[model samples]
Target: MAIDLLKRVDEIQAIGAVPKILETVAAMTGLGFVCIAHVTDDAWVTCAVLDRLAFGLKPGDELDVTTTLCEEVRDTARSVIIDHVAESTQYAGHHTPRIYGFQSYFSIPVFRADGRYFGTLCGLDPKPIKLSDPVTVSTLHLFAELISKQLDAENRQQAARSDLSSERETAELREQFIAVLGHDLRTPLGSIALGADLLALKVADPALLPVVERIRRSARRMASLVDDVMDFTRGRMGSGIRLNLRRHDSVHLTLEQVIDEMRGLHPERVIAASIPDLLCLDCDPERLAQLLSNLLANALVHGNAGTPVHIDARQQDGKFVLSVSNEGQDLAPEIIGQLFKPYWRAASRSGSEGLGLGLYIVDQIARAHGGKIDVTSSAGRTAFTFTLDNVRPVST
Candidate 1:
């Protein structure tokens, strides 16, 4: 009977005439009437009904949904039938027979596809009758199953819409963040460039030259931060940037270029570098140069003035480890974890010149090249180490 009702409900849903079909089913069953009631607040409300003999009852009627019969079906997780409403002890005080003039009632619990109870499909009659027919009971049960399937389908559609909304919100936030980054970086960068250009024209004051160089270095740092933000955005959007990889001397050429740039800007600070002569690696040269420049600049800005900043490169365990160390205050353990996160600055630093994107860019570059980067700091020294693929041949 349950399977048959489910099949009928499917047919009703396909036609989008469940109310008409339900009414027809009730009238034809000869049980005085039939009703499809939805459970709400432990009470039954008529959603659809079939009554042709002017029984005075209509659709959208409410009844005691929490009565013994309904509660019994729900609690026992099965169907219930009251053949004679007056004689049945369970239906004595129920409002069905007393108020609505219903003497015979048969109700099957409706369940969703996941087997959660949703409501009930019931048949009613004013005249006393026996509800012992197996075929009738089975049909009602089947109808309940059909209702469950429709409910399941609607729930799935709602969930899909919710997911789509969440995705749209995420995209909007990303766009807003990018817009703010562009706005913040433009003004400082322009000021730094203009200041450096003006300083280049004057040669009389030696002290002013150092200040001018600082402005230029700071401007370059801001530009690098902007680039990192753009790259990270591109990566998140699934448009992977193409790496311009080339064979280059890892230690000799790259470090020399980086050190030369830093030295030209920081003439007073001693920068020491030791790189092996013939070590070569396949990597994006521009990215490696930027990485080194960022590390060196960070050391100059944060490390103690006049203290030597050391750059070391060597092959260790079939990988090339490049390290930059300088004399600086030790960083707290908590700060180290967030060092590679964008826009995160250490508490010890002041004068927010860059967008804290240096270490983050280094991390991204290393990961893209199948490598890694890490740092160690103490009271007197801080070091950043990065690794790249060792493309050099092993000597016998």
Candidate 2:
């Protein structure tokens, strides 16, 4: 059978305040037994208790509703106080006092924040004490009010947490949708690029050649933009950029390929590259190509038009280092701090410069290889550098 949910709810509401309240009940009233209880028609359950007399009562323990004095307070919705149960006319013959063997009894009906009667905060002792005193009864009343306020605050906090959980789930769904859409668009984009290449061969007219070339260039640019979008979605929605590192005979081949592709796209811009093979790379080839491509594009657009963009890849000691340098005005310190943040673009550049995910993707790729990216710009010379561990990947 399922547990009694109402009893469990009462236990939760009393978690923090009940312990202090029970302690206060005994210290102020001089009662040997002090407890917070949940009384209903069928059961009387202990929420919390200070059992100085070895009462053996703890939270969730139950007594028959018919046998406890708390049940009378629950039914009448009033306090029950007998300074000396043996001398009082009302409780002298009462079986509850005789059964529990208590001479002094004190119990007050406790209400919830919503003004509904919940149970009782009760205390009892074998010896008769000053329960009839006004100061003692008022102290019990204040504690019951304090417990009600605490329970109300807890309920509000729980509701806010539930709302936040729902919002997080919704955000995850939106990220998935963006990733799926980016993947689906790639097939059609590939067809556009292929069709441009086919038309260049068929249309031999010199006048139409430039138009075909433009189509090819536009298609290539669109593909690059698609790549940026995919990386952004992955970094935000997924864990990070995944890597498939392998030991290559030479890493120079991929860096040279990227330089050649950059030259093809921007032939007018001067390019100088140095790739002296010093170490074999244990890295992801495709991701490395993408990393260099982003750096080259940034250099060609932002660097001085007449100066050459320098690309260098070499092994320094045991670590592999790849760097790209160019002539440019020094970037502000504030801008450098945000260089690897996604979608953070320079205000001087146009929107057509693409979503500013290039450096962020480059940073993620380097980190996947247990490497880091560093950049410095000053005195008309700016360089972006990447350092990789150049170690072999152990097979899983």
Candidate 3:
């Protein structure tokens, strides 16, 4: 139980919202001490703590189970609230309050999403205060639920990573887990994005706005990661990527929007896009736009900083061909084919810009549209081109 508890604590601590959640809990409760404790039959260990009173409890700190009130909460699988430890006739005889020397204390039992009793979200203050309020209880409960779901996500992700490494044995399980984690991530991510928006509008602290913006950016990156993983799972474990192909006369505009957005993100970089023939194609407009985005982003990430990336979408021989070209160190002849393979990262990529699935997803999108993607590198210039014929299928 302690091993699992420590693992879960590590998982939840990896999540970005944990710090905010603990801070908000302390602020809302007006308590000098708040903690998430992992309680077993014999030991109570702090998973996380916020101590304004110099309580000296860090993650993994252990306390005597008999000396902590959470032991009772764990045993009963219910919350314990003591508004005034000295005034409560029931608690006057209890040793925990006297041992801890706290006048007010509350603990809400926390459970895993699978309904296994896990721990407690508990807080205490030296002076007596009103603790049985509706808002406080509800907030703690909601935060507990959120923490549980976040822990579940982290556990799933960890398993997926493990399975990914031992590909031959656990590939199938990894695919299923990745699919589940990808879909399940959307709700909590949406909540975090919404919370960031609320912070932007409600909080006026000049220094804190950047932190909120970082949260918002991190959330967006997480959403992209989820999408990439989902695509890889579907393309690998199931059939190839299915598409909703449709004829669009204004597909050029969609590509333009993608370029504009990319430029806004990296304004100092130059990206030139031209679709002179007024693109009209029987393809998935959105997926085609995604392919272009992936290619352009790759170019920006690996291309020479002083050079401009060029993108051209053209109608040729009754087929739509889109090409992205960038000046960079020419990739070797051997490495070009692996660019579209799942999780294959080029050695030239300097940072963790992606899991190398961007190009793979782009390839899948192309194939879903009854098309093919190609790449060429020569004389320090690398270009990726995608082509779909006019005889596109109506549906997948």
Candidate 4:
């Protein structure tokens, strides 16, 4: 059951050269009516037409498939040509000529590029014409071939456009879905954190203090994961990480603050910092703090827990340079290359592992500031460095 008749008809009509083909065909063959028909197992529908004999058939018109000679053309995958139907031996008494009163007729089978039968390039007239001449037959074959090739090209282009549209729609839905989920989840997380704070103040038992702290930590981690997911979607969706850039007189203090916070979070781990005093820089302090925090968190998680993580921030040659390094087993070239990609993690997993978006977000922030993070892993130390040139110092 080949349904969707209109779609098939439109496909044929979309070929801009189809009308000219039909007109040229009718003129060369001396036929009063010529058309391109979409023939199927049980249907014969006109797709395009050049009618001169009051044939009363136009595009989208249909005829009983069983009553037309085109049906034989479709069945045989061969052309049916008749110069004088009434004088011919084969079709002289054929019911088709008497029913439609066409003395001269030709229906050349037109095939799709995939070798499936499509329909026919056909013409008809009341007066007999020299349609059996080899020159005329060959020219008609060429025209039919031209239409077949053109139809295939049009269909391919339409399919490509449709695929692109579908891909874009899927990407939009994915971004919207993740953005909404991240936003909706924050409200409950905030409530849990607030409740934990209230519990900590009221609970006097030493046994319950740790429980209250655990709840606070879990809520905060969940909130951080939500923020990472939202940022990931935004970065990939062509809107990079947002920033509020301004001159800060104590950018080095911002770096020190991040290190101090990380130390408080993991009091057991040792961290070493070397940042200059009164370092002035034009940058988004909060975003830089986040970038440094993510790097420190990643280092603390993956670096050798027994070794101290080192942070170095400085301003030299009118540029700000920051690097975080840890002593650990060397990472392979492949692993180092994929470290900045989102959701990428080494095979080993610890209970403290996050959603693996830290480095990816770090890279995004660096790029947003017109800088890039460089990685060098060898020996027993791995370092991630962020460099921003042309820095503007804060006014005195």
Candidate 5:
């Protein structure tokens, strides 16, 4: 089947994990060059590449389909792994190895969910290395499968956007996304986190610790993105945020812990917290912690760094009131109105920091708790207060 090569390239890039996958493949297999290519009947195009051997191939770059083994994979629907091209009887005299001057090579076919061939996750190294280990081969194959599943997710998301006006279709799409995000996306991330933990335990080099930490951090960040998307899906699908509500006498302690954690994360910035001991109230402690974390993160990103963000949590007039305020430029009333909407970012702060669902999730949590978040911005001060009605505090 013919495919739009440009659109395919964009789809691969949008997965956000392709580059990391390529880099991880290279590191794992000791391959100098790794890439995810779009293989078709008459064309072989690089969709994403990690070039450590100066192979010089980049995204959108093309090579003659006849000269690449990926085309052979496309034809046979099988992977080709040659640990040592010079010693392998099957490919000793192959023209591809001779032309590309590679002693090690592998091309694993990636397929869509419906079994249609998409492309190959291929790598090559000039020096011969053991690439045929059962674990190594299986890991690479798993990576290819991850790409295929992510491609399905990207396609479904595009379709969902196109069918926004159709309520039934939108619900189905949300379910599809929830499944993909909950399983396909998070499964690999959990593996990455586990691998990082194992690597940290085994590696003794002090200099390599930071690299391990970075891997851990990236894994955490990706997991967080998955979580945000899942919450957003649940919130928008009209089910609302799920909560584990229970009575707690020391909810203030959880709020204080969240503030302390944020302070530790951003030592350069000041966070003024006043969380007094409060009587028992009914709420989801874990969900409230998540809510506070999201609010603090939002303030830290959009709030002024020079001034301290003030957080006050206490009972007020038979109601539970928790407020977070920061000194910053007053948000326009129009902008403030849209602050709780999903995927909304301010024009001045359009960056790749988050998926812009933090505030939206916060709003959902408030609603789930039979409360509402009110925003007030004036004279360089903005506060977000959550007030849950009919909070009759009981004695501990």
Candidate 6:
């Protein structure tokens, strides 16, 4: 019998006409209040109902699933009758009859085809009645099966939507990754080729050795960028990245490393640092280095080369505050708001050769470490600041 009920439910779902089926069920049942509730451990919560004569019961009301008559039928694996609540030991003091102004009630257990109990299909009346008529009870049971079918169909549709959304997002990320890879790879490859050509020409000048070193540094940076991109992708897809947390002089060491790299690109710029050597933080050293490098590079590319770029890191109130400021024309309000959005670059610099993923990646890395990034721009200066927890000062 349960198998037949489940088969009927499948047929109802296959029809794919929820509203029409519900209307039909209401008319066929001819009951004052007809409801379907799904059983949970503690309650039978209403999922759908046709209460044309609204008796204040809503779609999500919960009744005790363990003790309710509907549950008893499900547990005993048979239908029970309550001819009149005032005469039954099981329901004499029950609230359902008095609150809904009903003297008679009939409920049938809803079950999966396998006879696994789910909830009930119930009907109520304001006067004494006999709903035990075989046809009425069977029809209500069939309607319950149909409700189960509707829920199953809805779940399948939602799963399809989720799958499609995931695919679309993956496709987009692949496109962005390809673009960044091409741009980053070209520069290092070009430098290595140029250096090889120079060496082949027997240009043995001592000054040329620096050029070879420069090529090697660029190649390493490119490799690091690739690794960062891979780690970021994994993290975004719900995988955790390993974080090496240790107390190290964060401000002094991180800023020094960043300044050294930026000076190689923009020797004319005055990059100033005001960081305490003793300020320490618990962070992944490599990720922090990448974050600072991105910020410094952004400043050099967008800000005036001759003006000063200021970096400061300090320990205050158990947090490490780091800021990078540059003397540049203030960023437009609209651009500042979306600075960290992936693939977002200022419209004014439309011709710049950037994939615009740097700031976005930095923001993600910061968030993964339980920190936040913020920016302020006005008049002649723009500053980006971030704070990290568990900051302390190192002892000499």
What do the candidate models score in CA lDDT, each in turn? 0.67, 0.76, 0.77, 0.83, 0.82, 0.63
lDDT of 2: 0.76
Least well predicted 10-residue stretch by lDDT in candidate 5: 170-179
Give a tens-digit lDDT track for model 2, residues 1-396. 116735444654435435544644564466889887777778787777777788787777888788888888988888899889878988899889888899998889878778887778888999988777664566567667655555555555555656876645545654565456456546755776798899998997999899788768766766676677677777877678978878776578888888998898789998999998534777889998999999888888888999999998877567888999999889888888888987677775442255567889999998888999999999999899999874543333
lDDT of 6 by residue, 30-62 (tens): 345666656545556665555666676665556
Better of 3 and 4 by lDDT: 4
Which residue pairs in candidate 6 have backbone atoms (N, alpha carbon, C) closer than 3 angstroms, thus clashing?
Answer: none
What's each prediction's TM-score? 0.48, 0.57, 0.58, 0.58, 0.65, 0.49
In candidate 1, stretches whose alpha carbon ends up further than 4 angstroms from where it belongs are 1-173, 176-222, 240-242, 394-396
Model 5 earns a TM-score of: 0.65
lDDT of 1 at 374: 87
lDDT per residue, candidate 5, 117-143, as tens digits? 999999999999878967567778877
For residues 104-205, write the lDDT of model 4, one tens digit per residue.
Answer: 999999899899988999999999887896756876887787678767766776677668866565456545655665676577568768989999999999
TM-score-based ranking, best first? 5, 4, 3, 2, 6, 1
In terms of lDDT, the poorest run of 10 residues in model 2 is: 12-21
Q: Please report, as a residue range, the 10-residue window in candidate 3 with the lowest summed lDDT.
A: 165-174
Top candidate when judged by lDDT against the true structure: 4
Which ranges in model 3 have alpha carbons more than 4 Å from their true place?
Answer: 1-170, 391-396
The candidate that achieves the highest TM-score relative to the unseen native structure: 5
In candidate 1, residue 29 scores what lDDT? 45
- Predictions: Cα RMSD each: 27.7, 28.4, 10.7, 26.4, 7.2, 26.7
Instruction: Supply candidate 1's per-residue lDDT for 185.
Output: 48
Candidate 4 deviant stretches above 4 angstroms? 1-162, 349-352, 394-396
How badly does each model clash, as a count of residue pairs? 11, 0, 0, 0, 0, 0
